[model samples]
Every structure is written in structure tokens, then in C-alpha cells.
Target: EDVHIRREVNALYVYAFCLPSCREYLSGSKGEGFLFPWSDLDIMVSKLPPEEISMESFHNDCAYIATTNGCKPGFCKLIQSYAKCDYYSRVEFLQLKQHAGFNVNFDQTIRGPCYSTNFPDGFDCCYALPVHPDSSNVFLRTFKTKFWNGVKLEIMNKNITVMHCVPKGPEKGDDDGHQWLISFSILEQNIVHSLNHVQF
Candidate 1:
């Protein structure tokens, strides 16, 4: 688990360097060392663009963004499908996607990672999953298998861990009071990391 966290930390740092406007730090229960075997890796990124402008290396950032967006379609379906499942439910489909390098996370009850920058008023947060070119091609193949009654018959991956979060309360309800509020896990992480060491 520590190894995975280190890898995730390095990945986020590398990706953050690609985006000059962004500064990120580890955040979440895992960031706070309060995670169990099953916890999502969280990294909080704040946008802080530098004042100076340089035209010489602008294409690299553009290319990096393009590559990140050009992920396989199965990856999208896997996230969407898993997200729709119970946030803590051990859907076998999730295990497969995790092996495929998809980070199983949550944004409210969405059951997946938050990757959008354009949000409505009073809500603005964005995160991008870092991809490795050398990782095995597990994403495309996950589409071939079908889940049965919210379960899979195949053998589960033992290496895969499950992280659970506290249940959403009534105060977290949306404007319609039907949906749970969006996750502030990232924000919470920032708060956790910024605390005074001895006092906290």
C-alpha cells in the first residue's frame, strides 16, 4: 500500500509539473495516514499560474494534455459503470479496472474520480488521472467480460484493495434534496495537510 502511495505521489508530482498553473500535494485519509487497505489516493491541486510567459516550450504542455485525453473508450465505460455502483460495493468490474490502472475514487455518490474543471457556481475543482504508457493493456479487455447480477464469477484480484468513506448525511443534500452533495475529500485533505504538526 505504501509503495502504491509513493508511486501515486510521484505520478501526481510529474503531472503537476506539466501544468505550470497547477500546484498539488497529497491529501485524503491516505494522505493523513488514516487509510485502511481500501482507500482512494487523493492529491489536491491548486491552480496558480506564474506571472511570466514563455512561448518556447508551450507545445509540450499541449501535447501532454492531448495524450492524457486520448485514453481508450473502455476506460471511460469502466469508470462510468463502476461509478454508478454502490460507492463501497466490491463490484468485480471495479477490481478489473483497478488492475487496468483506473483509480477507483469518488465525487459525492458519483463513485469515480473528478476530472472536470468547468463546474457551476461555488464549485470548482479538477483532477486528472495520470497514465503510464508502459502499463499493461487491461482497460480495453475489461469491456469483453460481462458482470452478473452486480457480481463477477471470475477470481478476484487479491492485490486490489477497497477503501471506504463515511456515509453522506442529510446536510450534504443537493438543491433538490435528492442527491448527495459533491465530495470535498480533496479540500479536506488540504486542510489536514496544512495543520500544525504538534497541535493537530
Candidate 2:
């Protein structure tokens, strides 16, 4: 019984923001029993839309709908940025403190990795903001698969860990919101690239 519950917590952790120690599982709820099956896939995305999507309307979609056709209402988080430069080039940022209500963290800090200033057209990781609770002016991600539902399973996916704020439009600066950035995995060299200005 104990072993079964452990697996549930770990699986949910992969999809949601949770603390192993803090989460308490119940008999049939979040505590015990198999909410679904066992699938081994780990994907950490920077939260985003279907690519080529912008930040402005992204928040509207989330705020407008409580859930997608196949997603939990509160499990997803948005990651976006409001930079005017070219993706992570010193742009406005979101205040996670104001949105998430509490506070959340990423696997790594979004800045400091020394990317080029004159970025290439593609090859840039989508800059990301933290998942905020307001669902207003935010970036986001959603889980499409549930263990117990549907069929034709294809797990094991990875996404570009969106890194910086890349904006192709006006600069709203900090106060307005840095929720314009979103990112996925860099599986291929097809996202954004550096322009050679920050050469080594």
C-alpha cells in the first residue's frame, strides 16, 4: 500500500509543482490507490503555446478557460517574457511574487549563461516567466496525457527549457509584465541562434 502511494506522488510531481515531503496522499484521493497507471517519461518545458504564439493572447486563453479539453484546471503554469530586444536581450520580466501568489522556482536561473547579443534568427530558447495564479497576463504549459484515459500512448518527451525574453515588438518594460516569453526544449537546433556579438 505504501509503495503504491509513493509512485503516485512521484508521477504527479513530474507533472505538477509539489514537495515530496509536504504532499500527503489519502486512500483514494491524492494519498493512496492508483490514480492511473505507470508511465516513465520526463519532460521539463519552459511553458509555452503551439510555437509562433505571443504572450498577450496567451493569458487571455488561460484566464478565459479554466481547463483544456484534457487538462486539470490548476495544474498548469505559464512561462512568458516581455522583452523588446531579441529573446532574452534585457527585456521586461514578470514578477512571480505578484502572480503565483506564493513563489515558485525553476530548475535553473533564467539568466547568466552568456548568450550572444546579436542573436541569429532561430536558435534562441524561448525566454520564460514563472507560472502565476492570476491566470492574467501569463505564460503556460499543459499535460495532454492521463494514465487512465484514452489509448495509443506515446510518452517520453522532452522540450527546450525556455531561457530568455525574446520580443519582436514594443517594450512594455518591467512594470507592465515580463509574461511575454515562453519556451520548449532545444531538441533540435531549430529555435533561435546567437548572432556572434557575444563571441568567445
For candidate 2, write residues 65-155 as lDDT tens digits.
Answer: 1212222332221233342232222233323312332233222223221121222221112233322233322232343433312211211
The TM-score leader among the candidates is 1
lDDT of 1 by residue, 1-200 (tens): 46455546764764667566544545545555564566555554433322111111232212211111222322211112112332222134233434443333323222333232212211222333222111112322253433222121221222111111111223332222121112334423333333444535
- Candidate 2 TM-score, C-alpha based: 0.21
Alpha-carbon shift of residue 187 in model 2 (angstroms): 9.2
Q: Candidate 1, which ten residues in sequence have the lowest lDDT sum?
A: 159-168
Clash total of candidate 1: 3
* Each prediction's number of clashing residue pairs: 3, 31
The model with the greatest lDDT is: 1
Colliding residue pairs in candidate 1: 38-162, 38-163, 39-163
Candidate 1: residue 66 Cα off by (Å): 30
Candidate 2 regions exceeding 4 Å error are 1-10, 15-60, 63-182, 186-200
TM-scores, each model vs. reference = 0.25, 0.21
